[model samples]
Target: MNIIACIKQVPDTNEVRIDQKTGTLIREGVPSIINPDDKNALEEALRLKDKYEDAKVTVLTMGPPQAEVALKEALAMGADEAILLSDRAFAGADTWATSTTLAGAIKRLGNFDIIFCGRQAIDGDTAQVGPQIAERLDLPQITYVEDLEIDGNTAIAHRAVEDGHYIVKTEMPVVLTAIGELNEPRYPSIKGIYEAFREKEIKVWSLDDIIVDTSQIGLKGSPTQVKRSFTPATKSAGEMLEGSTQDKVRDLIVRLKERQII
Candidate 1:
């Protein structure tokens, strides 16, 4: 089984900051980490590899050179291979263009039985890339997958919905977006980390390396445009009630009624 796990290097939420001038994230100085949800997806892939002796997990990412860090982390966690899709032409791509680029790269990589990705990237929070990639590849996709098992060429997935989760069975060559409930991610072991750095030389692919239409990638290809961006105003502090327990209860109810919160 050939499994591909798509991952991203995102700004650490706690240290994230926006550039007031560019209306974009200030990534140069801030710390970066693997998207939290992508870790869960990688964990699921590792579990599948463990179950199937022939399964090979390959991690892929598209970003600046620093994104190599993320691929290395995946390798250290048990991925058999890592690929980096990097190029100036891929800059400023929206979800549509991004997925298109990824789909092209996957085609060049050869046959794949399963593709895994996070439900959404923390930075974008759009949750569109995974489904869009499936669309581009003409493959069925299962989103918000909490659990998954493969038998023969079929995949049984538990998909999360508003009410509850429901099981869905799909054929091989499918895309799956994993949720946090799937499984706990494993840390890099001493041996794994050593092998990741010593034995692996992550393959980097540029725009020319993959089959892509120059008119269908990067900022020029993106239909969505940002007119302006700014942080929301800080919320006002809440009022504090003071008195005996009974008095405080009465005051709370009065405030709630006054604010129409009840």
Candidate 2:
């Protein structure tokens, strides 16, 4: 079985800061880590690799040259191979264009039993890339997967919803977007890290290397335009009501009534 896991290198949110004047992320000094949910997806792939004797897990990502760090991390966690898609033409791609590029790369990979991705990327919470890739590939997709199992060529997954989860079954060559509840990612072992850096090679691909339409990639291919990026205004502090229980209750009622919220 061939399991492909898609991951992204995102800025550590806790350390992220916005430039007050520019209203843009201050990434100069921020550290990058694998997107939290994508880590869960990779973990699930690793677990499956452990379960099937013929299973081989391959980790893939599209980012700058530095993004190879995330793939190395995946190899350190037991992925058999890693692929990086990097090219200047791929810059400023929105979800649609991004999915188009990824779909092209997946096609180049030839054969695959399953493709796993995170439900959403922290940087862009659109949550559209996975499904878009599925659509482009004309493959079935199951999102918000909390649990999953495989039987021969069939995949059984628990798809999370607002009220509960729904059981879904699909054939091989399907896409799945994993949520955090799926599994906990394992830490990289010292020996694994050494091998990943020394023995494993991260194959890099450019736009020309993959099959894709010239007009459907990079900034020119993006349909949506970001007119501006800015931070929201800071919220004001809430008022504190001072009085006895009855008095406070009466005051709250009056406030609610004045605001037409009662």
Residue runs of model 1 more than 4 Å from their true location after superposition? 239-244, 254-262
Q: Write the per-residue lDDT of candidate 1 for residues 68-180, one digit (tens) a residue.
A: 99999999999999999999999999998999899999999878999999999998899999999899899999999998988899999999999999999999999999999
Indicate the worst ten consecutive residues by lDDT in candidate 2.
Answer: 224-233
Residue 83 in candidate 2, Cα distance off native in Å: 0.6
C-alpha-based local distance difference test score of model 2? 0.93
lDDT of 2 at 226: 65
Error of 2 at 89 (Å): 1.1
- The alpha-carbon deviation from the true structure for residue 88 of candidate 1, after best TM-score superposition, in angstroms, is 0.5
Can you write out model 2's per-residue Cα lDDT over 71-175, one digit (the tens) per residue? Answer: 999999999999999999998888999999999999999799999999999987989999998999999999999999999899999999999999999998999
